[model samples]
Target chain A: MWSINYYGNWIMHNIEITDLKRLTQLVKDNHGYDFTNYAMSSFRRRVNRILDLYNFSSVNGLIEKINTRPAFVEEVVNEITVNVTEMFRDPSFWREVRDHIIPNILLNHQSVNVWHAGCSSGEEVFSMAILLREMGIEGKVKLIATDLDNSILDKAKKATIPVKNMELNEKNYIRFQGSETLSKYYKEENGVAVLDPTLIENVSFRKHDLVRGGIFNKFDLVLCRNVMIYFNQNLQNEVLKKLHESLFKYGYLIIGSKESLIWCEIANKFIVVNNEEKIYKKIRD
Target chain B: MKKRSIRRSGIKYCKVVGDLGMSKYKLDNTYRAIVLGGSAGSFQGITKILSSIPDSFELPIIMCLHRLKHVRNGFVEALSIKSTKPVTEPYDKEKLKKGKVYLAPSNYHLCVELGNSFSLSTEEMVNNSRPSIDITLETAAYSYKKRLIGILLSGANKDGALGMKAIKDNGGLTIVQDPNECMIKTMPESALQATTIDHVLKVTEIIEFLIELDKNYK
Candidate 1:
């Protein structure tokens, strides 16, 4: 009953709900990572993908490996946390940030603090840095980017991307209407796009878990876009509260276009800045 | 070719074939949702199917149509213009309603999670599709099991084939548009090849089947 056929050749086992619960418990007990709060269906999809990738026939095999190998847990963590992102995703949102939000923040403070929570391989951080540089305000902005996976954080620090992905990133940059071409920010070498090191000179990339990590500092703006969609409601409420605490009073928070804050615990504290782009301004602490 | 002839002859022909083909299966009013997956050349057929169904149709229609990743607007509005039920792109975690149409938003994998809500993902594209038909159908099958009805339409890719198979494996009813009638035969043909589909239907017959199913709800 567990085996199902796809593509006529492979008989993939369906990871049942009970198996998923067992796997989550095993990961929590063996490693310190807790995946219980992650949305079950999507998490199950990722775990299934891991099984297919590693050619494991059953969840028990994955659990046995986790029990034996200490280092393999990092790989599991990296795969579990999706890192799909692009530079200047939703260009109109970036335009709003460049024209309205950033300038508005600068009027009050000499320097602005920005946090890219779940930065995910640094695309958003680099995009923001490039934007700041374009406005001649790179020196006035402090950026801290963090993700749960240290492996991806290292890539974010390195600032290199596959050349194949640059076409879409450049297209997004054009749509954002940056002053200079996106080509000015990166060099193509050995089939990879090596972004200018200076693009992240002001960015501090760190390994921070949004679920487990404490509010380390207040921010003028926090971009936690697309990160909370993976969590169930209770976990989303917990993480939203942590994010609300991480922001300064009246600071802006931008989530993914499809994500909403209306159902969260702190819904009353944030007023909609732009509903279409999912931007909100904190009205109270 | 005309609507009059289709209503006159097509409906009768389809009813007889449907009765014979589906005699083993019973419509026990257990179906929770209808999932439609298509890509490339499916818009017209989907519009036809949506427009033909009455607003009184009770089950929610979840769609995973491949679309432009960056162009986020107008698609749903365009689909809504002809649809009897209001077509929308559901926000992540939005609950599935009884008589609405939910389209998978561009550049995200739409999953039908347990507890009757949606969850979106930005995982790498499967079969080069972010709004992957397989992901949506598989997850819907996971949630609805035997209560799910999956319909596959015309497309150039083989994405929906495995999804149709998944639905069949979950004891759900499966239908695919007749390959000969499809603008692109690859999709429905692949589905036909992948699993033992309950029906291989023309667009008009598919509409008749749905209208009949809706009557059971009333």
Candidate 2:
């Protein structure tokens, strides 16, 4: 099936193996989003989604537009990053970290440094702060939260949450054995919950790209939840290596409930602390 | 070797110019096997039939269900809750086993070639689908030639009809859900007209027939 390719979009009856190779090249050359080892099905759907949104009559047209417009490429790349997250997302996972992972850190390390990579909009940072405070470990914890999106970081710094999300947020918070209602954490006015400044006193929000580099020395815990699923396997493995290097000896790494280190080259470096919660503890080399 | 012939007949062949380095397997006449393809309104009927079959039932059931891309990982959980037999999404290179049902994940084509082992490919969208009904049924017909039972259930397209006909031509059983009984009848109706279907039954009767076949044959 012969086809014309412009920026990885092919106009053909079937997706040729040659087309995939060309797509890989185009992504690298133009967008810098190397999708070479991403699951093929996932890569196809994302391309299709982009085509639909752009309202291109065919893949050819979409490619033409993308080749001509750099902003379009940026939008498409952002769309591909699935950044869906929630506050204190999995309560059980947080509980496991608090009970099992944190105590081990307290034993060897008098002070702790934590990095929450891909920390979208700071709900999770606040949640982590609350956890540390409740444990009387807040003073000992230093957190540096970063994500690729500066807009999200701005929102995170503001600590303002949409009013509608508060009800469910409160429910999830209480389910996590929160001693006080979520309403107590933020005063409601003008349809926004301005998070208490105290929760983020030791926390710093920055624009850090996982695909690029994070400028932090060492940390006890790296809580990167629900952010890697959208990453191509190569990117996932690369990011995992960076996280592995960043963790202090015997430090912890936590991923999404569904995410795993099984397929990574560094899978043997960490022992699973809680498999279902996806909490892993770094072991000595 | 003619492009015109392929375009006219709706069947195209790409002669392997060189070895693609894929391992090949061969099998002789296999035992009775069921291959099912459905989408759109497939979940209810498929879950019911799959969940009703016992683990003791001695046949392999390969199912393809269409799903929205990147859906949560509760399909096995849901199907396991509903099915009497164990339902699992196939891991890459996992060997095929009997008495267990395999469900294709949201966005991949699931095919069974010779040797009864399943293969997943992301080559292209067939009939506008990744987990295409036609791809699954067609590959099974190519492999199981005579022992296959191809079933077309509730779906919104004509994906399985041509593949179902291939199964019948290979001396295998071709079944379709009675159009009236199907939540979406276009696919079942397509199969009935395009192929020599051996049976057209309601979902309940299909389950009963499977049970009876398992009891008598196995």
Candidate 3:
């Protein structure tokens, strides 16, 4: 195995492409978690991080752990998937949603159906909830949030975030120009900001793997921001198709500000509503 | 776009001759990509380098520069104002093309994948930087191997030191902005200590070198 000395202290074993294929195949066969479709570079980096975090000597060592302990697969899955997210990330996108997209959605539909695909730790779902509440349409929207990792989905259900992250979230909220201060929505308890439970009360949190899961319901707006960045072209096309199918005809699809649908199979079906914020309107069934 | 196809042919030729080892090439037309890493005081230097390069420069230029995590919109536009070639922040999995410039997006760690595409991560910050110079440089080193040109510029910290070392170790050409001329020498000085850099050029000299390299492609 090839290794590199990080800071001349710890040697990081380079997780080769062949090793990734082996690990992904093993996970697919044994645990039924399909990670083969993940973008190889980022997935390999995450696996490399796991090796260092757990002090595994090599990829084989990680494989050994996966083989011996059935419960360890959950831990591996958690580590493999990235969960870094914040409230009101890319605040301009949120602003565009409030000023234009929501009003546009409400014009045709009395009640909006929203899906927060890959909602990590619930910041974004809560952000949407708060936005709907401030618009006085909280009761008029049905929200469903899903993630690949059950642990993170549980955290999302909890609606609590560390106090340290609140400052950045608050800054983002201000930039988003919300109806009220972000603090008005959450309470501080023992160094964690506990969001108002009412905000997420109607929201259903589920463990849905975008790669393997089927489309359960059609939505008026689907926010799968920053999630598809982890997927390869084949998986992205597949997921985009599922996302497209999950949306009602002419419904809105808002992705991360930097994410694009231009290169995907579904590109021709969606009209670019707001290019800078990456808001799209599905034009074709 | 035609330039890109030509560059692609160059890449295929490089691969055919690659097993013979890269050190023998000496910055010939074999290089496929150019990666640059900078921090604190490097923006001016980088902009100067970017603005100076001709529009005909064919190598894909990938940059990892430290910027505020929350503030995202202005950097690319600012870089584009004077750059001859358009500057862009590539979306995740976007393929790298010749004759284009790519900046690491804010709040994301930009990585160069083996397939000549970008893979971004929300992974924890390395050396307190989201677009960690080390990650970009190391990954670029791995992907491009000897066909990469890595340049370290002025910065307050040592984020790019290990990256420069990686580029050097992978038989890629390594360059650092001259410490004496840098606004803040910590970054280049750190790289100088970390590895044997190929050229320690001033900003103008770096621009000239790039122009000369572009002429070779012509």
For candidate 3, the docking band is acceptable
| CA lDDT of every candidate | 0.88, 0.70, 0.87
Which residues of candidate 1, in runs, are more than 4 Å off? A1-11, B1-26
> By lDDT, who's the top model here?
1
Better of 2 and 3 by TM-score: 3
Q: State in Å the error of residue B86, model 3.
A: 1.7
Task: Tell me how far the alpha carbon of residue B15 in candidate 1 is from the true structure, in angstroms, after superposition.
Answer: 4.1
Q: lDDT score, residue A5, model 3?
A: 30
With candidate 1 superimposed using the best TM-score fit, by how many Å does residue B137's alpha carbon deviate from the native? 0.4
For each model in turn, which proportion of the native inter-chain contacts is also found?
Answer: 0.64, 0.00, 0.58
Per-residue lDDT of candidate 3, residues B14-100 (tens digit): 556655654213457889999999987888988899889988899999999999998888999999998888999999888999899
lDDT of candidate model 3 versus the reference: 0.87
B159-185, model 1: which lDDT tens digit per residue? 878888889999999999888789999
Q: Looking at model 3, how many pairs of residues clash? A: 0
For candidate 1, the docking band is: acceptable
lDDT by residue for model 1 (A201-228), tens = 7689988888888989999999999999
Error of 3 at B171 (Å): 1.9
Write the residue-wise lDDT of candidate 3 on A104-166 in tens digits: 989888999999999988889999999999999998999999998999999999999999889
Ranking by lDDT: 1, 3, 2
